[model samples]
Every structure is written in C-alpha cells, then in structure tokens.
Target chain A: MPQGQPAVVPTDGLTTRQRRNRPLLVLHTGEMKGKSTAAFGLALRGWNQGWSIGVFQFVKSAKWKVGEENAFRALGRLHEQTGEGGPVEWHKMGEGWSWSRKQGTEEDHAAAAREGWQEIARRLSAEQHGLYVLDEFTYPLHWGWIDVDEVVTALRERPGHQHVVITGRYAPQALVDAADLVVEMTKVKHPMDAGQKGQKGIEW
Target chain B: MPQGQPAVVPTDGLTTRQRRNRPLLVLHTGEMKGKSTAAFGLALRGWNQGWSIGVFQFVKSAKWKVGEENAFRALGRLHEQTGEGGPVEWHKMGEGWSWSRKQGTEEDHAAAAREGWQEIARRLSAEQHGLYVLDEFTYPLHWGWIDVDEVVTALRERPGHQHVVITGRYAPQALVDAADLVVEMTKVKHPMDAGQKGQKGIEW
Candidate 1:
C-alpha cells in the first residue's frame, strides 16, 4: 500500500471473487538480485495455500544447489508424508532435460530449452499445477533459443487457473506486454560494489 | 551475476575465508512489491544453512497472517523437534510487540517500534542470530520514529557476525548510504494497475 495504485482500472465488470480467482502471469525482470528469489517466495505462498507447485530452472547449473530448492523439496516430502501442504515438482533444464549429465553443445542446450518449454506447455494444458515458477527463464527467450511469440500465445491461451511466474534479467518486451504484473529490480547498491565477494548463504 | 559488480574493490587484503565471514547490511526499498517477500526468502536460505533467524515485522498488521510467516514457523517447529533447519523467532510491532491482541494508540505503536529496534541492536551485539530480517523497517526511519543515524552507527559498530536485511519503501538516504547492499524495486507493471485487488497467497 506504500506505492499508490495506478490510475488504470479494470474495464471488465466482474465480481471481486471472479477477479481474485483469475490466474496471473507475473514477470520479474531487472538488473538487480532477488527476481528468482521473489518467485520462489511466491511459490512458497502458493504451497501454503494447498496449491500444487512446479519449478523449472533454466540457467542455474544443476550442481549449484540453492537453499529455496532444498526447503521446498523438504516441504514437498512433508506434503507426501502428512498432507500438510501442496505437492512440488522440480526440474532442472541445466541437467540436459534428462537423466544424462552431459552438456553436449550449444545446439544441445537450445534443444533442451525448447524441450523444457514443451513440457511446461504440456503441464499448462493439463492443468498439472496451480503455480508454475519458471526460474531464470528470460535467458532462453533473450538468447533466441525459445520463440517469444509462441510462449506468449501459449500463456495467453492456457486453460484452468494456473499462475505462471518467469524471472530473469533482460526480459523481452513481448513478454512484458503479455504479463499481468512485471517488476523491474533496480540496483541502488551492492556489497560486490564494495569489492565483497558473494557468500554461500547470502548469494546462492 | 546479472547486475554487473561494483567497480570498487575492497581495500582490506583479507583472505577469502575471512572476507566471506564478514556480516552484511542489506537494504531493499523502492516503490514496488517483493521487498519484504525477498527478505523472507533470504531468511529461508539462512534457515537452510542451520543459522538462527529473527524476523521483526514493523508495518504490516499483526493480525494479518502472511504465508511466509506460516512456512517459516512450520520450519522452526521442524528445527525444534528434529533439528532439520534453524530456529526462528518472529515478532510483530503492529501488535504492540506482545502476544495479546490489542490495537493501542499511535504513541504505543511508536514505542513498540523503538523497543523492537533496541532488541535487534542487543541481538546484534550479543551475536544472537546469524540472519535478522527487519521487515518493513524503512518506514520507522522515514517517519522519524527511529533515528537513522543511531541505526547506522549501531549497525556499523555492532559486534559479531550478524547479517541484517531492512525492507520497505521510502528508505532514507542515510540508511541507503550506510547499507552494504541496496536494491530499489521499480514497478514496470502491476496487477493493481489493472484495478485488480490484492488477493490471498499472492499479496500477503
């Protein structure tokens, strides 16, 4: 509530319940940290709401284990054992989209990215999850590995109440136009600016 | 890695281990969302690292049960019973810093905010927690309820390895200059721009 609401108002005459129920397409893109982290936080919220959560990691290496993944995976296990929260499915495109650990070539990486998008599309069509977090997804789109038009089309046409969040720097304008919410993180200062290196628990 | 590192290098020639061990002062502020949410995500990371986590909510009403609080509280319980994660202590200034549900006068709220900051300073001095999340703390300094100079001095002169993250809009210039890291959340687009109201699991 600190930031005043925009002057624009919804033209669609829907009830509050209807508006609240509508799925959201959120994009977190900017030149600062915490975009993916914010998305993960959103997933945590959805999990607490008993909504199925799906996380797809694109740029981060599979070997680099982030803490949110550990916490969410643990929560997922808790859900299975006690049914306290929603189920979670985590997949890493950095792992080559399959069990094999080999990183073949640029073409291979592109193909893997496309394959990952295809799988997301399948899940969206099937309504497999209520909250979909495409962590570091902007890179593929920015690099031209994935077609932005196709992604926009698929997201616009997706069925069911599925909320999607894509996070990364240099998010394309097409995606921005299609998204219901977009946040651009601007860096005011950083420790690294002061010549401090990234620490284990703070950065990753 | 997305935002380029600052050109300034540390003048102190500390070893990698020594530099990594130093505590950080992080500030998240701007006219956008996710400042507090991102701080919560950082707390989640600290919990995964088996570090003590302290969260002090300054602005949000105590009666509002946000999802991150629920998840962190659950994680805290897990830590106590099985020692799976770290211990978490959450306090809210909105509830007058007490367990009793009472909305006191404005003076009472101001008093509670100061008390909360004093407790944080004590904890920092005592090295009580590895990570301390001062959620929505910027407002106190901006509103002149707490002294920014005192805060900066306390943080700069504090003992032990205590990392603090302060989040809110309208953060004071003095506080921003004092922080080791500062992120300004800029709004490109927001759902509220479309006249959609904040909903459960998403807003809280």
Candidate 2:
C-alpha cells in the first residue's frame, strides 16, 4: 500500500474482511458522566466488525470501579469470540500512595502524572486503533491534575481513520475543536433532576 | 455506480480538485442533546475539507424550541451554511397532541410534525453525502412515532459512500444491529443527583 493509503476501497462495497481493518478513535469519559459503559458499548461494536483494539482507563484517584464491571465482561466476550489477547488495559497515574486523594506537596509529583499521560498519548498516537476511548479524561485537566495541551496535540496527530470520542462536561474548547464529534448532554427532563433518588440498576 | 455500491471513493484519494475525500458519517443529535451544534461542528469540518454535502435535522416536535436558545441557534447556523430551504427540514408522522405547562391540545400538529420528520429522512437517504447526521431522532421510535424497521431498511438500501450516526439513549436493538457505530449515554455520577443545578453555558 502507498504511504497513509487507507484501504483503497473503490465504489464497490467492501469485502467482509476489508471492512474489518478500519481504525477508530474513542474517548472514554471521566467524572460523573457515563464514559465507561459507553466505551464498552463501542468496543462490542468494534469486536462485531472483527477489529482488534486496545482499551485504556486512566484513573488517578479511584481504584476498582463497580460500573466498569460490565465493560470488562464484554471485553472477555470479545476475547472469547476472537481468541486475541486481553482487549482492556488499565492505567493508574501513580503508585497507590501517590495516586491517593491527598494533595501533592511539590510540583514533581504533578509533573510525573503529566509525563505518564504523555506516554499514554504517545502510544495511542502511534497505534492505529479500531477504537480508543479516553474514559473520564477531561476532569484532570480542569483540576490541574494533568497536562491538557499535550493530550490535544497528540490527538490531532493521531491516525485520521481512528474515530475518537471525548465525554465530559466543561471540556476545554480546544479539545472540542480537535474532536470530530462532541455530544453535550442536557437535563431537559430527568427523574433524578427532580426529587426522586437514583435506583440501582437504572441509575448506576 | 455499481449495484449496492457505496459512494465512489477515488483510488488516489483525490477528487478532481486534488484534495482528499474521506467518507464521512455525520450524526446531529436533537432532544436537548447537542444535535445541531454537533452537526454544525461537523459541517464546519466538511467545509474545511471542501466537501459537497447535504445536511438535515429529522424530528417532529423540535421545529421551534423556545426554551433552549442555543439549540435554536445551532439550527440557524446549520440552516444558513447549508443554504436555503432548511438546515432543519420539517417532516410529519400522523396525528397527535401534547399537553403542556403553557399550551394545550392542538390538531394536525402531530401529523404536521411527523410529516416534517419524514420529509427530512427521505431527503437525507436519497441524496449522496460524504457525511449525514440524523439529529434528535431516537425517541420517535420509542414513543411509537416512527417505524424503526423502515428507517433501518432505508439506510441500508442507500447507494453511496455514507457514514451515518444516530445519537440517543435506548437505541433499539434493530438499529444497533444495522449500525457500524453505536454509542449509549450512561449517567454515572451527576451533579444533579446531589441536588446541584446545571451550570449555565456548560449545560446548554
């Protein structure tokens, strides 16, 4: 194939196998938004299309979330169907003690987290993915927990066939500008917005 | 064009103009979710790429939403950019009525609305587009306003290089089955769950 030549699909429909190799970019959201579950939904889709993908969850403060369980199971399902190695990968910004909720005393710790995010960014940019979702990523930038510009630059430089999504409220305009798609959710009518409490299966 | 052919993609990646053309699927979400805004964003992108395209927003109840100013503004922008008749097309679906905080029942209103939505859907499917987004469309089927199977059939039968996006929660399994891309919105933790109000511009 010529350099950066996307599969030369003529006007005709793609053969079943030709359709399988297209790369994707997915943004796994962080914060109170539902990034994890959505990421799984897209992964199931990528799996259906016969694409091998890598999934990373960037978490600094929390460990072992209850909500991400379904996604892991779905990843297991994808592996079962394809017999590929693990499809889901997890990254904690710091070692347990460093990633703890306590405030960092010096800039060194903060710098380290930035480097870690950059390293991840480098990996994502180089690897052409069937799908990549940055789960709950924007919150760190807003709170000074991560370097924002580096991530955006890396995303811009990422493989164009890779379809990327970022989900978070109050996201930086630069990030939104970089993304091909953005979904800003509103509360026009919600049960929780009213006085009712969230029930387990539906809310969680 | 070959039978069942997707839109023609040049083998050299260049159209007659020498610029590359990427087969795009643009999905504009309505229903208080940033449908028009997202669509406009993509349109701006397509313009940047010098793409020949058509844009349509297919929904019955949303022709004019006074409560949401940004939503209306988003529609306006897309309308202007697409030029003339509609960036937002009106289609109908039978007859219906909705009771409200301000206004009460009205006749032919539901029919007119459905007509508006159907009109948009028809125009979008028949036309050749690099990207097409059906904005604020998910709830119609859930509410028995539109036929789910027919919509899927129309999209599958289209002869072009098209990437379509349908955004909303509770997407029908039939739709999911037909889709190369599927995303569901999950509300993990929201400020509203704790009685916090939505911040201005952020929520809008």
Chain B TM-score (each prediction, in order)? 0.92, 0.56
Tens digit per residue, CA lDDT, model 1, B1-74? 53455366576898656776689999988888878878888887888999999998997777777888878887
* Candidate 1 lDDT by residue in tens digits, A79-182: 88878768998888776764444665553778788888999999999999999999999999999999999999999999989999999988999999999889
The C-alpha TM-scores of every prediction are 0.94, 0.41
Top candidate, metric TM-score? 1
**Alpha carbon lDDT of residue A85, candidate 2?**
27
Give Cα-based local distance difference scores for all models.
0.84, 0.43
A1-204, model 2: which lDDT tens digit per residue?
A: 012223334444655344433332333332332344444444434443434444444443434443333333434444565554234443444332223434544435456556656656766767645455555566666667775787777777776455454555557766655553344443222222222233222222
Lowest-lDDT window of 10 residues in candidate 1 chain B?
A: B98-107
Backbone collision tally, model 1: 0
DockQ for the candidate 2 complex?
0.02
